[model samples]
Target: MRHGPATRRGRPAVSGRIVLRLDRMMVERGRSLGWLARQVGITDANLSKIKNNHVSAIRFSTLAAICEALDCQPGDVLVYEADDGDDGTGPRP
Candidate 1:
């Protein structure tokens, strides 16, 4: 059997937390993923995941490394975008 897309009903399941824009900052700094990872003593894959926002959790140690390498504050690396209505699903992109 196959399944079809469900009809939009209640609030959309949108995440109130918008993604962090660390990748952009990294680019602006001309830093490569491998370079940052090496500087911070983390694996390249791990850094890539964080850069892509695929990480669900981060430790204070890791956060501190990133902040130190980038010479920026935690707030400078992340942004909080409040969820606008549409339930949680959010407005149509």
Candidate 2:
């Protein structure tokens, strides 16, 4: 089976990364894990796993549910940080 975001050496991919900002969104929305879980119809434990980036994949349905519950778009909760091929400094685009 295929995996996600892992390189041949089993390290996270260097080119790019997907970040879950669920915890930050929850905090900004003043919502508890348990509460959001209830709203999203998922278990708190599962949500926690996603929040902590322990899981490599998430279903589209789940993502939609979370987006709906948070009253925000996907971009508000997910972020992409380009690695810039090892150079870290750059002016804002």
Q: Each prediction's TM-score against the native?
A: 0.69, 0.73
lDDT of each: 0.76, 0.84
Across 1-93, the per-residue lDDT of candidate 2 in tens digits comes to: 545688878876667667788999999999999999999999989999999988888888999999999999988888765665422234665
**Which tens-of-lDDT digit does each residue in 1-93 have in candidate 1?**
325444376434545574567887788888988889998999999888888889887788988889899888877677656665333234556
lDDT, model 2, position 92: 60
Instruction: For model 1, give the RMSD to the true fold.
Output: 8.7
Per candidate, the number of residue pairs that clash is 6, 0
Q: Supply candidate 1's per-residue lDDT for 73.
A: 83
Q: What residue runs in model 2 are displaced by over 4 Å at the alpha carbon?
A: 1-14, 84-93
lDDT of 1 at 17: 73
